[model samples]
Target: MKSKVIERIAAKILIEKYQLLENFYPDLLSGITDIIQKGKIASRFPYIEMKEDEISILIKAKELSELKIIELWNNQDTEEFRALCSIYFDIATLLDKDFEFKNEEEIYELIKIISFGYLGEHNHFVKNYLISKKELIENISVPEQWNSRLLVTIFKGIVCLVAKHSWKDIDNAVILINQLRKEQKDFESKFLNTVNEDSRPYGSAELVSLYHFAKTVEILGQYLLEGRVNGNEFDIENKIKYHLSVAKEFANASANIVLEMLYKYFEAFSIKLINIKTMENKVTPNQIIELINSLPDSEKHIFIENGKYWVTQEWLCGAFAGRAFVNEILEDAVQEMIDYLYKHIGHDSMVGNSVTKSGFPNLERVKQYCTPVESEQD
Candidate 1:
């Protein structure tokens, strides 16, 4: 059977089993049926070629009992299930232009499925689905299990806003990103608190999520600066300055967390190595200090004093270089540090090194980078 036939059959089975259309959107059922009969529903299957297993699952779905079908639908790990859900949403949209999702459960369900699909492949339909639900997306409360997925979805939405280039979109993007950063920090804190061990490193998932948001905000700041210089349609120089300032703030926050995590990891590793007395050439605090001392003058701002380690842009660069010594889990932390340094110091030509570099981001320096050059007329 053709893909559309299988998809339509899958949709019918879903509707019959869950009665979602009948219960929540009684008016849509006939429109959905009419469109299917007339072949007016556009093919919304993901662009990738379906695996044989997924095709087999869909073909056999018609034979399965309702319980079995529900099992398949709930099994998010299977490609066939995601495909089915995508088709269901596609049918809904065709039937009703607004695709008004009535309740939080429905929205959460959609985000869970779409977020999974988004991480694997760049699905334009899924992204558009999220963009269409922007208001609901902002307001709904996500369950604990699905918080990470929701974060990923919101991050993608912010990226979409940056690409659109309108002033309203950019302003909304700024708001969303700042909100996203806060959510990520809270998520990470909650996650770390749940771990039994006090010295265990930060979760890689949280680290990577934080890194992506921080990097995206930094890019958005640059885009705002470029817009201020190139366009006259929007007088947003102050907005650009504000955005850069916020971006610097986020970068500093990310850098502080990453640095602390790295320090804890190193401390934990040193303790582990020290416990293994049989092993020769174990890592030591003094050795780490010597390594820090060997860093370039620009990086001398990083040092261990009174058992506390400090981070600077130069130190972050050095940490990135020696990242291999750290565990695989800290890889995202290393990348975050490098991106933070590059954003604040590496490419910025106007800002000079400061006497009181606090190992955190200098907002003044960031503003200096945003200051328009003499040649570019306002």
Candidate 2:
């Protein structure tokens, strides 16, 4: 009975090492037992001399690594978690061949080392580590049988997202996502066949990976659209605004600026003219100036003296000028009017100063669609 118990323990390790499942376990056990009975365990080729010191060293190293990880989590040190993940990955690689683990948990802890996004290292190491031991992962599936597929897919997606810009290499990201999608057919059979609904959260990691892959595709699509816009000379006022409004929902700050500029340019094309019937009924620029000047100095300064053009030739100038109020309250609406030209139209001949200085076109030319006199009273 004592010998039988020893055989069972040895068989467990052999099954884990070779990744043999229930069907092959008995034959694999018999083979290992023959080798042990023949005294080939220690005298054989490709042998590792397992000593008490080596045993104690691996135990201490694993314990130290686990404790450090726990400390990092408790301290909320994101960088430290990233750092130790690297250390554990190296240890897992070095121990793969000759080290004898006492049980499955130790082996599983090493596998979890790779699952924590430690894969920012070389891709070849990551790819080989995942692809080489397909059988081992299949037999030792702990979190779920399909966790290996999801983990490997996420690692590949992160690599593609970080390296690519302007839609470059998006195909690589698509390939990883496509592989995950293709696995859906077998999912019900491989996963749903044995899983009970009592543990609803059991397969959450798989769902998370699916969701993340969808987001990655959306982000990549935004970059691609931006690149297309940059290459083409579409009507900036009309076409670009529509594209960028959608893009801004997905992109970061740099892309947001692009969207804002496009909106401003489009607004320049759409001016609201101040309609006056005839000279009797008309409020000409001069009349508007006189009316502005007749008020008290504080009020006069707000409109005419400042060379404020409330009318945009193409769109309502007051509307675009008013955006500065978002940052501060404008107590002096006239000084606000004075600074408006300096803000939108520059001292230089080229109009729409902000967009022009930013290297966007003089889109104010499109403002010819509406009539606004842009001149100061002498």
Candidate 3:
């Protein structure tokens, strides 16, 4: 048979089989169809093409019992089979509340495939399904034999998904983020202890993981601030602050290992703080200044040399300087930060170009504090 013909046959058989099983499965057929449709659409992007064999694998996998499916998953190392495993996991969530893989290794492999493989279409479904499985995710114990970095990748995937759909379960979202925060701290502590100065520069997996998870928490916090809350404004504001605190802690811990994270962390923090100051009316200019001052002075010296300025630091300074330019109340405190940055990084660099290019308001005043390359050179 032609490959296209075989794929169509496999797809038809799978659709019909899922339809019949839907009576017992509930939404099983629709779920598979949704996965296929989305997968096709996602394949339009480069480096993510869906193969015809994947459909055949899904058809064969769907017809087998759960135990057989697991056996197949364990035995096969092909991309098509991994794609099938991802689909099986997604459908299993609907079928069994207590459904779990044979071991953490299997779980890790499945997540690895989902995170980096051609399973982009199943991500949304799996993410939504896992939202209700917080206990399952939390209870799964990581054995000492399993790779901790793989575990981090799994949690990072979960965190990214939950953070994106935070509105679905706000409280659960917060709990998951807090859990990830603790796990990150524990992982970093252990990983750092094993490293020496020679390996420290290359030991960025944990740091990058921290950056991703921290950003997700920050995103979730931003979502909470923007959405209508059942509680008081103080409650929401406190939550936002909690999220920011987590980011700050991560930034401080990672500063020595990866200096760029510090700049990125402050950039995100400054934007969120500005939002709270302008929208919530809870954060004061003094409070912002105090927080900025609390950042370690050690990291600032990196930019003190000529031609050593990082674009990230420029972004960080722009975030505050732009806000200060628009709000008179924030001018003095923000100017203090900008001056401190300017004194260190100097005026020969593009200080606030990011803010200006982003179309920040009060452009003329922002330029005054955040001198552009053209103006500085002139």
Candidate 4:
């Protein structure tokens, strides 16, 4: 998520979107500013009552567009999508079609926002260009390079493939999934051949997250392909079961990976902070914040800072998602690393527990099923 960009054509395009949207949506520029006084619009982040006009959001997004890629990426600013076409296409092709991109950074920024929630966005172009885009994406020179997007493409293909089978339309779903498996295999091999634990290309954590994500679906897709989607009986009852199974798997995988994609980038920062010989001790967010504040007025500012978007651990749409789930993993990951470093350096007992302090309560209260069970196997 380290972003450093001088040319932000994608940024400009997004700023321009406010202008472009007036043509179609007719709300941004000239309106009486109902958004500030409106009933409410749900947002991915915590929603707040607006005391200012709606244009302030756009105005802030404009400033956000100019920030260097690293700061922008660390923020994972939602405004990134305000310019990139979210509704226009799925994460798979959000960048496939041409844009007036001035640099690779823009493409990366576009990819970041799309990847964060790819599974949630339907590929509107699937029926028309899934195959063609597969061919085009083949030429991109690296599989891991386009990690999350590739996962989204394959997962979307799986959804389409299994959807037909779950409806007792086995003849067609089988054909479609076979083709998808073939194309996906080709794509998978290209990346798998080059990437490894050490030789990972950029966005490696996202790539790993994508790998596990695709693997989870691929397992279910295999089951569906082999007539196990609903236990081989193609009845209406079995069909519904198949669909429910796929949904269950999708929820589990989504809950697990989406935040991994967010938190993995901090691995290096965590290591460096506690690695100093004199400071061979564990640190918490509270500790780190205190240390940074203790720095001299003329000292260089620390790159690490509070996240611009609130990181939450609770997710309730399905599975164990929501802000609480996200925050728990994030806090635990941070504390674990802090503890591990302190121990590695031979420090005294210093570790922290991740408590569910706020946000939607532990989603276990709402989810009827547990995380998909893992069976011992070869």
Candidate 5:
């Protein structure tokens, strides 16, 4: 069967399953005009190709989309009702991933529905349904074998923890985090004990594990640092920040180790930045930029435009070279390194947010690259 056809059929089933189209149903003939004008629904379900009844329904959808029926659906607070709305949002978006439905109000409604479980839904029908979905998703692990298997498991675990937040208890969250921290520490301790400086450098398994550990720490750090559990801010923010800081340290260490393990394998390994100490033939930032410009468009894009670490890539490589050898050419590179640190580490820029609790220091470069928010409330 065609996947799109299956999805369309499934969408109807899901709407009925969630019982959304009933309570929030608009006039049967009301169409979502915005979807029609944008050609979103028309392209997917062409008006000419559809049966008479299907065409009527599509017209209704087009008009309802125009009238913002989704927003109206969100105003209802019942858990079953909110879940029904989520089904529509999921169906509309799944039909066209890039479609701009702008249905956050619907999503927020579902979030509210689930939030009731955190408060007092021990016997509620919605609570049981949410828990069952959570369990089903949690049970499906990626079918990978070997050392990479650990990475898959860890990744799934992280995702499950994130999803579980809506229905999980805060005390449970704290307990789970602490347990993860202990597991992480224990795993690291055992790995370190198994390998010392004289041992063979890390293999793919070790590399994967380090990456997973870093990501796990980052996720834990964001959760604990942000204090997102029930609206009440954590009673011990200091303790939480400290825990997150330790996670940050681990993530940083993992990044450094990954760089050390993989840098030589890259194609750009031949180009070395001059060391400031020995004062050799050093390249200026302009010269470096020109060299980067000389590269093929594809390589240049990877180096300077969009890939991970692209902005910091050049500076970091130069710093690495400076430490690798003692040459006079690297003197300028060293000074440039200092300049980079001074500019990024200690300054605030135009994007400074004086109101945030974290008081994150402004990064001029990050501000320069930041995407603007289209909606004011966002």
Candidate 6:
């Protein structure tokens, strides 16, 4: 029988309703020839890279200096400049790049621009990209790899909590986070007592867990810190930069722990390969092979499985490396990360109030975990 394909529901909702690259750019250019004319938008830009060029042109030709450029950048035709600037501005906003824009209007403007693109030429690339991202995001499911699988369990639990903003979602989110706090009481009786397997140094799957924990935690924390948000017209377009920033910080903390664990595992694995038994320079390749050949079948099997921690191939003597399995998981997640930022850029670069919103719970977040959204939305 053929296996069923699982669609990541939360990721899809985040993308489409939140306007992650969902036609915002194509919409901006729909009436490009008319709304932002050739000679008219001297200080505006079409793409992200051109913003600097636009500013330089304004300064050189029109003789606008630093303050004047700021004035022009700020005070230009609201609809025209916003639509142009936001391609870069909104991306920066989502990324919290340089600084965040405080005005709700600016955020609202992004929604408008993305909505415009929805009606015009659709950017299937952005949509496809975001949809593809949905596949990468999973709750921390593989718990067997950790020493303290319960901590792994906690990480998974907290991840779900902070992943949404509705009244029901927030209530549960609060409950989950508090549960993690309470778990400090027992479960081997150490506070936040993670596996601490730096010595045994478990597999890289732990790192994958850490990565998802980071992603999930960030999403959830953002919801709590920022309070509420809506996707599309239904309070979904914009919200909670402060909360997101905090959540990202927390996620990075988990990532750091994962990094430390991976490095230590590699260190331990490397030591095993070296010639500590004889205490001379490291053993010769032939000597290492001979040593392995002498081992019994069970030892050999165990050696190979654990040896995978140090290197990939069977023949190598010593390259001093671990498999870095986290990279595989990270690779999938990183693509979604890139797409999310790009979609925000697309959304941010809109003009006027003629924006749009889709009732979210479609993809990016809706803690219950359902099938992905493109099939339903499409």
Best of the candidates, lDDT: 3
Give per-model TM-scores. 0.28, 0.30, 0.29, 0.25, 0.23, 0.20
Residues 76-173, candidate 4: write the lDDT tens digits: 43554423333222222322334332334433333343332231122333323434444443343322334434543544444343233122332333
lDDT of each: 0.40, 0.38, 0.43, 0.35, 0.35, 0.30
Top-down lDDT ranking: 3, 1, 2, 5, 4, 6
lDDT digits (tens) for residues 74-192 of candidate 5: 44445553443343333333233232212323222233333222222221333344454454435544332322333334333433333443213323444444554456544644555
Candidate 4, residue 77: CA error in Å? Answer: 26
Candidate 3 lDDT score relative to the true structure: 0.43
Tens-digit lDDT track for model 1 on 23-113?
3334534333333323332334435343454334332322232223245643645645544444444433333333344443444334333
Best by TM-score: 2
TM-score rank, highest first? 2, 3, 1, 4, 5, 6
Ten contiguous residues minimizing lDDT sum, candidate 4: 351-360
Clashes in predicted model 5: 25
- Per-residue CA lDDT of candidate 6, range 100-154, in tens? 2233232222222232222222233223322332233243243332324434443
Off by over 4 Å in 5: 1-137, 140-172, 181-186, 194-241, 256-378
Instruction: Judge candidate 4 against the unseen true structure and give its global Cα lDDT, from 0 to 1.
Output: 0.35
lDDT of 3 by residue, 218-277 (tens): 454444433322434345445545544554454455453232333333333333334433
lDDT of 5: 0.35
Compared with the true structure, model 3 gives a TM-score of: 0.29
* Cα error, candidate 2, residue 60 (Å): 3.0
lDDT of 1: 0.40
Q: List the residue pairs that clash in candidate 3.
A: none
